[model samples]
Structure formats: structure tokens, C-alpha cells
Target: MLDTTGANPFALSYNKLMDVALLLRKYLPHMVSFGMFARVTDITPKTVEELKNLHHLKLDSINIGIETAHDPTLERMSKGYYAFDILEQLSKLDEAGIRYNVFYLNGLGGKGNGVASAIATADVFNQLHPCIINIVSLTIFPESQLYQEVINGTYVEEPEIERLMEMRTLIDRLNIRVNLLGHHVSNTVPITGALPDDKAAILREFDKAITKFPEKELKAYRSRIWHL
Candidate 1:
């Protein structure tokens, strides 16, 4: 479920999604495949169980912008949820046999914490077995609070090369079988492959970025990106 407004769909009512699901199943019975973007904090055991009852509707896929499993980074960005919440909420989905794709915001922990962020995020993701881990490098726009933080010296954006290293670290530590989608517009290098199979090739690409590409070139590419 994609929300263009970036608001949590179930923020208002836990039953809202179920209500919609019922309508879809009744009116459009042919529509079986379904996916939606949802916040883990907004999902409950009841929501999963209720959806499971609708065996005819294939609402088995979900995309969650988990961002980072690092608590300090989550709080710094004001994500309104914590690491444990990710574990608890997602476990409900796992139990209900729902497949999910998650977003991993590279450089979310800022300059010094990039590696740590990757390790922490990978730890959480490994347990859940996400279908895809979408890797996006954090980009701070002028109007964003993060931009203000950067201006005020409260936060430091990760160096482009470091961001690549962070992504490599995440890939290296991931023990689960999942797709790593790094083709987002925010990424400097578009890398897409499955883990444990393309692991070596993926690491090679990251190594090339870290060694072959000049930092200035990567920075220039980043500067050209105005939005996510």
C-alpha cells in the first residue's frame, strides 16, 4: 500500500484497512494480489488476524519504511517508533504469513554512525526475512528538519563513499535470503541482486565505488538529486 502523502494509513483507525479490504473483496473479487505501505507501529495482531480471515483476498504483501533499526537514529529523525516496536509488530506479520519489503535508509545515523546503523538494521532485518530490503541513501533537503540540523551542526551527513561502505556492511552482515534493491533515485550506483548468491558481486560493486570513484564525483551526483 503506497501512501504518497507519507502518512501512516492505519494511523486513524486500526480497522480502517480491514474495512477497505472487505470492500475490495466484495466489489472486485478478481483483484486478488495486493500490497500496501504500512507503518509497523500502526499494525496490530488483530489487523493481521482479520486479514487472514479473508482467504480470497491476497493481501499478503506489505512495504514498510523501516529506515533504521538504530534507536538513537530513529529518535533523532523522530520516526515515532523504536527498534523493539519493529521487532514486535513485524513478528505479528511473520506469524500471519504476510511477506514484507522494508526500506533501509543508508547513512541514517549520520557521519560517524553509518556502519553501526547498518549493523543494527541488519540485525533486525535478519530475524524478519523481508522479501526485499530497499536501500536508499539519506538526502537532506533545505526545507527538511534534518537540513536545519545540519546547518546548526547538530548532525553531519555521511560522506558519499562512506554511505557506500555502509551499504556494503549491511550486505555483508545480512544472513537472510532477500533481494537488495539499490536502484532508488537517491542512490549513486544502481545495484540490484539477491543476497548469498550475488553477495560477492554486490560487494565488488561497493568496493569499486569506494576505490574507483572520486568522492567529488559522487558528491556531484548527490547534489544533482533534489528530492527522494
Candidate 2:
């Protein structure tokens, strides 16, 4: 069967899911394997079970943006769900036999908290199973609320070097076997490979970048990009 998906499939209500099933049957019968993104708060045990039972829909995979498992950083970013909520919801997905990929946003904990955030995130991830861990660095734009927080002195952005260090720490600490993707435009270094096997090489790359790349050079690269 061909894989078919949408930007945020779980955002659909029960009736909308039924509508989609009917449309798929009528227009794209071969498109049975489904995958999409969802927020941690949007995932519920009931919804996961329902998806599992809906054999025709075949929603088998999902992507969740679990930026940082550190409670303070999660709260600071105004993520509606906490670390416990993430574990609770993802456990439901596991029970329902659904696979998921998660995002680990670098520099989420601000200036001095990068390493702490990395450690906290690694702790949470060790207990779970995700096919992929996608990494992206935080890039605050002028129109974003985070930018306002930066202006008011309530939030501080992590430096590029610190972000690289945080990324290295995360790679070093992760114990699970999964693909680590850092190809997002916001990242200073594009890294992608399977974990444990490629862990040492990934760490070495980060170490090289940290030692050789000047702060102004990295900051300049960040400034040139307008979107992530």
C-alpha cells in the first residue's frame, strides 16, 4: 500500500476521520498507510485506541514535537503539556502499536540551561521508543512572542557554541537505537544518522564545530536565515 499523510492528521475529529476514510476509499484505495504530526496534548489513550481499531484508516505513525522534557523550559515555552503528559500520551501510542518520531529542540532552555535541558530530555527519551529524533535549534524572529520575551529581559537565547555543546551532550547520552536528524535549516550543523552506531562520530563533529567555529560566524549564519 502507498503511504498517504497530512500535516496534522490527529487534528481531525472523529467525524472528520470518518470523512477522510470514505474519501480515501473512493479516491485513493491504495493509500492505506497513514502518518502525520500531532502535539503531545492532542494525543489521548482513547484516540490512540480508536485509531488502532479503525483498520480502514491505517494511521500507523505520528510525529510529536517534544521540544524539551525539562519542566521549567516546557513551562517557559508555554507548552500546554508537561513531561509527564508526554510520557502518558506516548505510552498510549505504544500500547496501541503505533510508531512515533519526536523533535528535540536544541537551546530550548535558554542561555545557561542548555546542558541541563539536554540531560533532562535524554532522561525522558531513554524510557521511550521513537523511530527518529529530529533536532532543531531555536531561532527567535522579530514577530514571535519569544522575541518579545527577549526584549523584556525575561528570556535569554543560548549562544551557538552552547547549543552545539548541548547537542553533543544529547547524542552522547541517548541510549536508544534511533535515527537522529539535525538537517533542519535552523541547525548550525546538519547531522543525520542512526544512534549508538554513529554516536561517536556525531559527537566529534559537534566538538570540531564548537572548537573551530567563531561565535560571530555562527551568529552570522543564523541571522541570514529568516525561516526554519
Candidate 3:
């Protein structure tokens, strides 16, 4: 229940006085038991410290959006920080002994650099070792810069199977253990598991479908799900 965007701007700033009256009146009862806290990025480092002061505040988890490990891809996507900067922030969070979840976008490196992006991302996650890693495929939204690229033929979306393969490959290479959650609407097949062990098996299942299943049968299966 961390609010990455809120008044305090950093998770550590949460305190009794910050918004005591309203929080107590509205959220305290439901949140107290689960240790809910919000993470606010887009704030200065100094402000981040102010937020960290609330460590005594009970929070089950904090979530942050790291986006991508490739700097160029992040720049193209107009994200605020570089890959190293994200790593540093995650390191700081780790040092504080705060559990966190990280969000990453798939197919962001487009065609040529997808593998590189995947590998770089795995390296970062392996280092940070967040409690959860949420892998999501890119969906073209009309207002986004990425959408413009797709419209102009500058960027192409990979087929669902290809995207799954890329993620599977990346997960296969990770050395650390973290829960992987891929339940976004853009993902054709939802996957959830801890790394290294389940990754290869899931990938193999998808590979079999892509390689052996007839297109007609696959379409029928997809159609049934869609209709249901």
C-alpha cells in the first residue's frame, strides 16, 4: 500500500504528525496490521532522508519503479534516472533493511537491444535482490512517446511469444532468489514464481507451444479464453 506519489515524497517521512488526523481517521485501522507505508520518489535526496526517519512506522513493503537497466532505453523512455542511479537508490533501501518491490518494463529496448536490456536488468536485480520483481510487457498508449514510435514504424512490438522468451531467458540467468510476477494485461501468459528453478520450466512450456502447437489450435485456445 505504499504510495510512491504523495505529500511526504519519501517513504521515510511518514510520521504521526505528517497527516495524523486524516490518516488516523481513514487509513490507520486497515493499514496498521499489514504495516503499510508509501514510497515517494521524484524527491530530493535530502527529502528522502527526512522520509527515512519514519522507519519506526510499520510498513509491510515499499515499491519503487526502476524501469530499465539500460540507460539509453531509459532516456528514450524519458525516465528521470540512469541505471546506476537506480542501483544506488536500491542499495540505499537495502542498507536501511527495508523490503521493496521493483517494477521493470519488457520489450523496451525494441528489437536489437532487447537481449542486452534483459541481461543488464538481471544484473541489477541480482545485486539489489528486492523482495519482488514485477516484469511487465509494454503496451502502446496513445499519449506516450513510445506510442508515437510504434505508429511511425520506428519501434515495433514483439509478438507475445517472443516477449515471453526474452523474459524467460533473463530469469534463467538471475543468480538471486526473488519472486517474479508477470500478471500485467499486456502479458499474453501470466507467470509467477521464484527465479532459477521455475524460470526454465515455464520457458520450456511456452517454447513447446510456439514450436509444436499448430497455429489453428493455438488460436482456438486463445479464442476460448478471450470469449470466456
Task: Report residue 214 deviation for candidate 2 (angstroms).
Answer: 1.7
Tens digit per residue, CA lDDT, model 3, 87-111: 7777766665557787777777776
How many angstroms is residue 190 displaced in model 1 relative to the true structure, after the best TM-score fit? 1.6
Q: Higher TM-score: candidate 2 or 3?
A: 2
Residue pairs with colliding backbones in model 3 are: 2-38, 3-38, 12-51, 12-52, 13-51, 35-59, 35-60
Ranking by lDDT: 2, 1, 3
Task: Report RMSD for candidate 2.
Answer: 1.9
Best by lDDT: 2
In model 2, the runs with Cα more than 4 Å from the true position are 1-7, 45-48
Residues 1-228, candidate 2, lDDT per residue (tens digit)? Answer: 646465777777766776777676678777756677888876753565575664436767788999999899999888887888888888877777878899998998999999999988898888888999999999999999889999999999999999998999888999999999899999999999998899989888998999999999999999999986
Top TM-score model: 2
Q: TM per model?
A: 0.91, 0.92, 0.74
Output the TM-score of candidate 1: 0.91
RMSD to the true structure for each prediction, in A, is: 2.5, 1.9, 4.9
Which clashing pairs does model 2 show?
A: none
Q: By TM-score, is 1 or 2 better?
A: 2
lDDT over C-alpha atoms for residue 20 of model 2: 72
